[model samples]
Target: MRKRYLITFGIVLFILVIDQVIKFWIKTSFAFDDPSVPLIGEWLQLNFVENQGMAFGTQLGGGMWGKLTLSIFRVVMIGAIIYYILKQIKKPDVKLEFLIVSAMVLAGAAGNLFDSMFYDFIFRDYFDPCISYNQVEGSGIFSECSYFGYTEMVEVRHRGFLFGNVVDMFQFNVIWPSWVPWLGGGQVFPAIWNVADFAISCGMILVLLRQKIYFPKEKTSKE
Candidate 1:
């Protein structure tokens, strides 16, 4: 039991630390809506933005209440995950893959939760308050810019709990040619996300890709 928990904690802690560290770096180093700094030409770029709502910058509803509801929902989900993990740990035949996948999901959710819970307290929002979700107004990646960390002139007025923005940095600007379907040479996969989002996405993908392996069907008593 101790070993199982240790492994679980190790995975969650490791992911949380890395996710927060990178986000911290991006948050402190660059401004919100900063131009895309290509790491691999235009294919992969570092574009900083903050998500005040759901994953991948999607808005949950409208105002502060919507944000709070989303944050609470995430906490509920995290609690459910913890309960599931604990129950599984007591089972003798629990699969390691399931545990790993759950850990990934937990870590990712916690990472983003931290941002929603406390980032507003720590960092000042330079973005125009009227511009909700930083919704893109124009075409192409160059149209956006990120705010560097808070300046002396800026005041850090934290939002009432669980109302901060989830910082996103990584971008894959895969613009297909004009002939390509709806893309029209525009960016494919336009959403910008962070490490936490990646972990959750990867974990879900693993479970989907290996559902049978992770959760094989049991033989019937008659058989």
Candidate 2:
């Protein structure tokens, strides 16, 4: 691959890896069932969050069906971006930058999708504390709940399909004064996101800025 393409891919991969690592750590350690843990007194916190789909802290939902549909749509979109990038390889000099941006966007989208597709199978619900699954006092709570299969009080709240819901965690809030009159910051947003989000953001910013600095010049050949 060319240098530009490699750089973009590298950045995308780096962001994806870091994002997933942070999410996995939180999944194993924190209990987001109760978010809003106090960190740095009241500013930052280690909270685990899951979103059905959407960018950080936002979601479009009509329930599981909605999420599944969105997930499928995203899969198609990302696939298209990847295809576009591969096609651009035929004209490396002309299409390097486009390839880079598209690849980063694709990678970011895929990284988050990976979480939505698999996290549910391995872990239980996001709202419940992990302790609920641990075998307290050695007898094994699941064994204790063995009657679930035959009992009338069986309440099974299972995590849905891998793509059933997207993994979203990463909410950055900047508190502005309420006295500003017309506009003051409120609660800000919903879920916490990961590095994939950052990669996409950076790629988009670069592409937007690139238009001005690298915009094509009109042909001024021999007249």
Candidate 3:
């Protein structure tokens, strides 16, 4: 039981650290408009982008209120998962695989939540030419406008708690063949995601694939 707990804790800590390191590196090193850096041929690349919504850039609602709601939802879900893990750990028949998957999910959720809660306050030096003072109607938000043939420094302000954008960097450059239906000639899995998103997706996929092992059916007593 103690070994299992240590393993779970290690996995979650490792994932969270790796995810945050990659995100911070991209946030400081890459510009939004910078060309994607090829990693493995033309198939994989580092494409820096910020997601203001959920996975794959899907928004729950509009503007700041929506972001706050999403962040709150994540907190509730994480709390429930933690409770479930504790209960399962105490059970004699609990499967280690189940605990591992739960840890992955928990860590992934927490990783993104950290960004939503603190990225705005931590990352204030970022400047983008596309979103300048005149473009956005706000006082605290400002950027250097080199894209418009002019350049100027502007004061930067935090976007407040739970309103920071999630940084995404990895992208698959694969495109669907023309023979495909609606997605013909379009980028295949075009969503730019981060390490946390990948971890959550892998954890979910493992759950689906190994459901039988993780949740074995109970034997019925003879009538």
Among these predictions, the greatest lDDT belongs to 3
Name the TM-score of candidate 2: 0.69
RMSD of each: 6.7, 7.4, 3.6
Lowest-lDDT window of 10 residues in candidate 2? 133-142
Task: Give the per-residue lDDT digits (tens) of candidate 2, residues 19-126.
Answer: 778777777776646565554655555555655565673545544455677777777878887776666665535555666676678778877777767777766554
Worst 10 residues of 3 by lDDT: 129-138
Q: List ranges where model 1 is wrong by over 4 Å.
A: 124-158
Model 1, 1-223: lDDT tens digits are 7888989879999999999999889888997656789989878999988877667877777555667788999999999999989998898888877888889999999999999887766765544543345333221222223457533222222265797788998989888789988869788889989888998999999989989987789978985
Pick by lDDT: 1 or 2, better one? 1
Which rank order by lDDT, best down to worst? 3, 1, 2
- List the candidates ranked by TM-score, beginning with the highest: 3, 1, 2
Which residue pairs clash within candidate 2? 57-191, 116-162, 117-162, 169-192, 169-193, 170-192, 170-193, 171-192
Please list the C-alpha lDDT of all candidates, in the order they appear.
0.79, 0.60, 0.81
TM-score of each: 0.83, 0.69, 0.87
Clashes of each: 9, 8, 0
lDDT of 3 by residue, 85-149 (tens): 88888899999888999899889888998988898779766634354211333335566646357
Residue 151 alpha-carbon offset, candidate 2, angstroms: 15
